[model samples]
Target: EEKIPGVYGIDTRALTKLLREKGSLLGKITFEGGEDIEFHDPNQENLIAKVSTKEIVEYGSGDKTVVLVDCGTKYNIIRCLLRLGVKVVFVPWDYDFTQMEYDGLFISNGPGSPEFAEITVEHIRKAMEIGKPICGICMGNQLLCKAAGAKVYKLKYGHRSHNQPVRLVGTEKCYITSQNHGFAVDNSTIPSEWEPHFINMNDGTNEGIRHKTKPFFSAQFHPEASSGPKDTEFIFEEFVNLL
Candidate 1:
């Protein structure tokens, strides 16, 4: 046998089968003669601070101004908003923008658990108090639910793929969506003012939420799918209309 001290082998089929049957899991790799490593859960700390912008960043110069909370936001989200002719103001996840004049507040997708993003939750709470149009994607979805007095929990495997199917609640319309997250909002915990807007067709998990009397809404998937189907891109237009 070849004496390779740091060789590794991965059985893709086996891993896929395991994930399909058991959902996503945490594991670690090790070498025979190397130091043992431990699996560290990324959701245990404040991940938003690590991925959010350090300073305020602006994009476009349109009439509608949107204060986007940058919690590890995806670039396509900003690109999509800019394409709609909206001025985008990217702020750190922990920064306060409630006092700023903006037509809407957008929370961007990011890594980690929403509970760890306590500051962002507080900011969203403040935005609700102001009653402006608010929208969120991915982790933004969970944060919005939490701010609205709902609870969130980690999924068994989580939805993390393109082509995930979501259906509009109380309707037969369904759309393929791009998604990436490890947690979901507990639908049963949502307050009366908010209701499930969309649900995953495959797993029946909450995919989106909307407020009954407020201009607040969020999706657990990316409407601005960068390299995926554009089936739900109209959601952005609807949000812009709300503004």
Candidate 2:
């Protein structure tokens, strides 16, 4: 593990920890075209084999929850998920795949204007159409609203601080949250199929929402906050239960 201020790098040990192997490699490396040994040592320089894994480049996962992310937004949420025993997969959220097979999906926070993410939106739509248990925060939340036929509107002044207060709606409980988004789900554009789950008590803007029927939900705040309050971190618990 290498950390230099805001940038970090991953090496082979990180890969091992991510594979959840107690210093053990699972299965065997197999080559394409089907004519080779199923197992071998990594030291074989003469081996003619290559295997492709549906790798989680940025996020970490357990043996179960296969979480996904919107590229670079996977940092803090991944740490929380891993602590909760989840197997995460983080890749550029805009990749096009005809079908996806995963136990669960988690979209992480990222910077930028959410409306410029058309490709990412399409991928999210496909994931939603597949109907797997999904959770999203920040940009992930915005994408969820977009996938569910809700409109995303930019705030005149975005919430980009860590000390924002988010009300859970039904309760007077207010969680001090970490947030960084200039856009929010237009409450009026939300379809009846979805129910607002959390709200920003300060402005009454939509903060979190869940599907009325499907196992899809999102939050506009960052719950997996590192170096901040973990008050809203229970969202990961909710995800584990939902999945």
For all candidates in order, the CA lDDT equals 0.90, 0.72
Residue 101, candidate 1: C-alpha displacement in angstroms = 1.1
lDDT at 87 for candidate 2? 73
Top-lDDT structure, candidate number = 1
- Model 2: per-residue Cα lDDT over 6-70, one tens digit each: 42364767776765544233355454597887564433321111211234364454667564654
Q: Give the per-residue lDDT of model 1 (tens digit) for 57-159.
A: 9999999999999989889999889989999999999899998999999999999888888888998998999999999898899899999999998899888
TM-score per candidate: 0.92, 0.72
Q: Which ranges of candidate 2 are over 4 A from the true structure?
A: 1-61
Worst 10 residues of 1 by lDDT: 1-10
lDDT of 1: 0.90
Best by TM-score: 1
Could you report the Cα RMSD, in angstroms, for every candidate shown? Answer: 3.1, 16.3
